[model samples]
Target: MVEKHTPSFIRKGSGKKKADTTEQFEKAVSRLAEGKYVLRLYVAGMTPNSARAIANLKKICEEHLAGRYDLNVIDVYRKPTLAKGEQIIAAPTLIKKLPLPMRKLIGDMSDEGKVLIGLDIRTR
Candidate 1:
């Protein structure tokens, strides 16, 4: 006669532990879905490109992120040290600082699709 071995997780009285773990994982996912976004926009100066980037970013944030985002606009011309710290080699760069896996988008931010993808915003 062959004896069948049951997995440890399938042992008796393990249902409670499995249920607890599942609940915890669900809570974590919920928190992440509702987490706030932190972003920074680094620009050279108040030039045309910078202006466009700022406007575009603000619009995008208001439309998608709404009140769940914190945006900081930095003038590299005035705050050279800050720019150097972030290793910014180009103007009109948007950095997503929160929600892990930081991302950088460089341009006038006119491409809404690309910006949305970079920011990990869901589009319906």
Candidate 2:
């Protein structure tokens, strides 16, 4: 199951609020301890390569990551600003942003082994 925590705001001049905030923060930290995966897939357009990459990525995430992952698919054709922000120099790029030691994999994601390894889904 996916873990979701609502941030508790601390009120001023209340010792109880401070303790509650600390407790909430610890709970949030504990929830993340299971290792949540944040992924971004950048595609140029609705080309064959882009479609394939999206399909492959979805399959991999369903099989390997399931509820533990958040996949954000960004189309450079539609939103060039997002592409520029990430400094993407190629189409069909996958960026793994969580679980520490961020990684980027470039391709249509045809090679499942390479994609899995690149995303730290599997040990090399």
Candidate 3:
């Protein structure tokens, strides 16, 4: 295993909002040096694609993030309101809501490289 340096994570109920401005966004990304990740996955029921996404994401998280991330799986079919709130147009979308500069990835998460890049796990 690579030597892991555990970063400090924002505690639950930290009430942090997504950064909007470029400066704020930069700050958010910089905070990743010392902050944990917060992730939310939106899916439509237990469809095949959704299931695959969940599984792929779990595997990636276990490998890269391990104890340093929060993963929330939301069934949009059951929570239309939440979907609407996030303006989610596609199913099986993963949203990284914390560690500054929120990010989103839309797919089944089958491509580990793409998912890792999208989630800022691997650069270049």
Local accuracy by lDDT, each model: 0.71, 0.70, 0.73
Assess the local accuracy of residue 55 in candidate 1 as a C-alpha lDDT between 0 and 100.
Answer: 79
Screening candidate 3 with a backbone cut-off below 3 angstroms (N, C-alpha, C), the clashing residue pairs are none
lDDT of 1 by residue, 1-124 (tens): 0011112111221122335878856754564587967677888877888888877888898888777775677777766776778889988888887766788999999999999989988544
lDDT tens per residue, model 3, 23-115: 766765664665778788888877888878877888898899878776767777666777788889998888898865678899999999999
In model 3, the Cα lDDT at residue 92 comes to: 85
Global fold similarity of model 1 (TM-score): 0.70
Q: Model 2, residue 81: what's the lDDT?
A: 72
Per-residue CA lDDT of model 2 for 35-103, tens digit only, reads 777677777767888888877887788888888875667667766776777788899888876766778
- Model 1 steric clash total: 0
Q: Which pairs of residues clash in candidate 1, taking residues 3 or more apart in a chain or in different chains?
A: none
Pairwise lDDT winner, candidates 1 and 2: 1
